[model samples]
Target: MSTTTMKYAVTDSLMMLRRSMLHIARYPSMTLPLIIGPIVFLFLFVYVFGGTLGAGLDGSSGGRADYVNYVTPGILLLTVAGAATATAVSVATDMTQGIVARFRTMSIFRPSLLTGHVLGSVIQTLLSVAVVLGVAVAIGFRPNANPAEWLAAVGILTMLIFAITWVAVIMGLVSDTVETASNLPMLLMLLPFFGSGFVPTDSMPGWLAAIAENQPFTPVMETLRGLLMGTEMGNSPWIAMAWCAGITAAAFAGSVALLNREPGR
Candidate 1:
């Protein structure tokens, strides 16, 4: 694309982004669960399970601090899935609505619509993550990450948000209804629980440990934990990046292909 065309695409994307943002602003119910659910989970884990699970994850010396630190990153990633699920619902609703057909006949850049939804979802996910972090801070959660480490953490999270939002987008595209679209990402939200998110993989049974150690969520949680708590991450950073990159690329390609396909085909 030429400079002018590129500029127009960017402008159009921004406008579409604004539209998506407005939809969020107008519907507080859509955002409320994203903010509240994680906060509830944070409280539940820290207050209820913290004492017992704390012992398992960390010995007496590390105790509660370890649980607080370990759970924070996992909850943060869950917040990302919440935001993506919302976008999936929005995209599914858009696909089912007559307005999409109207837009199809217009001279607008179609890619901007999906781009706008993705950008808007990422922004919302970051905001939700911040809220969860704040809640964690209000409790006893503390991290030793320096400024540079903090920046790297944010970069990792942005990639995660980007990667998952596209998967949500494709789910939205494939589903025939908004309800179906929303369910897929909800299933994704459970990934953290099964991985090394809340606890160490070694404590799990041999077969379960093998699964948890190899999965994408474990790598991501490990990377985040390493960044924040100054733990040794080994190859988790590289593995996490590889997982996110591959998922994002595949999902983006699938979304574009599905979007370009004829409605009745």
Candidate 2:
């Protein structure tokens, strides 16, 4: 917690980050799937089912009821979620390896180890998000935001990814094995569908509609959509940030406590 410790932690985190990135570079298959999975969903939703889904919207779900604009944000959220799953798996694998035990004997910054995996995953997430965004742009899905708006959008996505990283860290630490950690975060990927990612909450049944409107993804998606298309901001930006901050704080605390409770896990 001292300035010296803080300085060392940052240095150690960056070093660990480079190590994680090198792993990804060496394992092209691991890197490819995380980037491709969301791209497939984007194409399928926008092409295969877009017309049918758009017809249901009937032009009431903002001007972006056209499937591409309506669903791009959701796919971006999926990209981050998928990256978080990878993060969890990587962390769990590290826990099982001899390296974690070796590090405990060294004088290196301990938290840096976790930060490395999470930060590395975040860089991957941002890369995947950019690829998705590029694909979205190629297909004529215009967000139409100015530079400032685009920056704001990026800021929100960054915070959201950072929050999800902590959650993945906690999952990785507490998991009994890599398989469990890998599979557990699948729920994060499904959450967008349950919320307002693909469609408007108002269009669903009463019970389903209520759930869709209130979930974390719904507000985040709504905020992103509004910012991109220049719609009403309302309270969505604040609400979305609140969710991100709350999750990040809780998950960071829990992950730290659990890591201390179970060393090398």
Candidate 3:
């Protein structure tokens, strides 16, 4: 792209991002569920099921504190899932509400509309992650990660959020209605449970264990757990980033193509 064009794109994306932030501020209801849902899961698992679940780990004395450490990575991913779902709904709303059609008729950079949503979702998701992490710490979740490890953890999370936000954008693009957009991304929420979110893969039967061990979220969760708790990381960190990069590339291309295909999809 030319320098002039690049500048225009940046300017337009920033304006759209500001619009998204304002919408978030006005409709605080949309963002609250993203924070509250994860917190509820954190509290529910820690207080109600922690003892028994802690005992099921390879080593533990069946304590809530032990489970708090074990379950935190999964809860964090849940926060990301919630944010992605919300992004889909937001994007779909814009698509169906005639705003996208109106934007297309204007002189602004076209891709900036989607760019704003992706960037805004990433920023909002990170904030939600921080809030959930704070609550986790308050409820006895502790991480031994140093400053560098904490930074690395945040880096991976940002990558994951960016990638998934694009995926959500595509979900919104193809959706005919806002309800379908919301429902389509619900699978993202279920991925963690099917992975290593709630229980160890070995704790499952052979077939189910295999599914948990191989899925995308499992490596990401394992990477987070290893970074935080000093567990065995093996190749999980690299594997997780590879998944994020692949997803980001594919989803970014798909979202842009979908937007460019139809004027008001």
On lDDT, the candidate that comes out on top is 3
Which scores better on lDDT, 1 or 3? 3
lDDT by residue for model 1 (1-265), tens: 9998898789989999999999999998888899999999888888889887888865445566678988899889878877777989999999988567777898777788788999998888888898889889889888989999999999999998999999999988888998898887888888888888788888899999998888778888999989999887999999999999999999989998888788867
User: Poorest 10 consecutive residues of model 2 by lDDT?
Assistant: 56-65
Give the higher-TM-score candidate: 2 or 3.
Answer: 3
TM-score of each: 0.96, 0.94, 0.97
| Model 3 per-residue lDDT tens digits across residues 1-265 | 9999999999999999999988888988989999999999999999999988988888777688899999999999999988988899999999999999899899999999999998888989999999999999999998999999999999999989998899999999999999999899889999899999989888899999998888778999999999999999999999999999999999999988888886643
Candidate of highest TM-score: 3
Per-candidate local distance difference test: 0.87, 0.85, 0.92
Ranking by lDDT: 3, 1, 2
Clashing pairs in 3: none
Clashes of each: 0, 0, 0
**Root-mean-square deviation (CA) per prediction:** 1.3, 2.1, 1.2
Q: How close to the true structure is residue 105 of candidate 3, measured as C-alpha lDDT?
A: 91
lDDT tens digits by residue: candidate 2, 170-262: 888878799999898998998789988887788889999998877778788989988898766689999999999999899988877776565
Quote the lDDT for 94 in model 2: 85
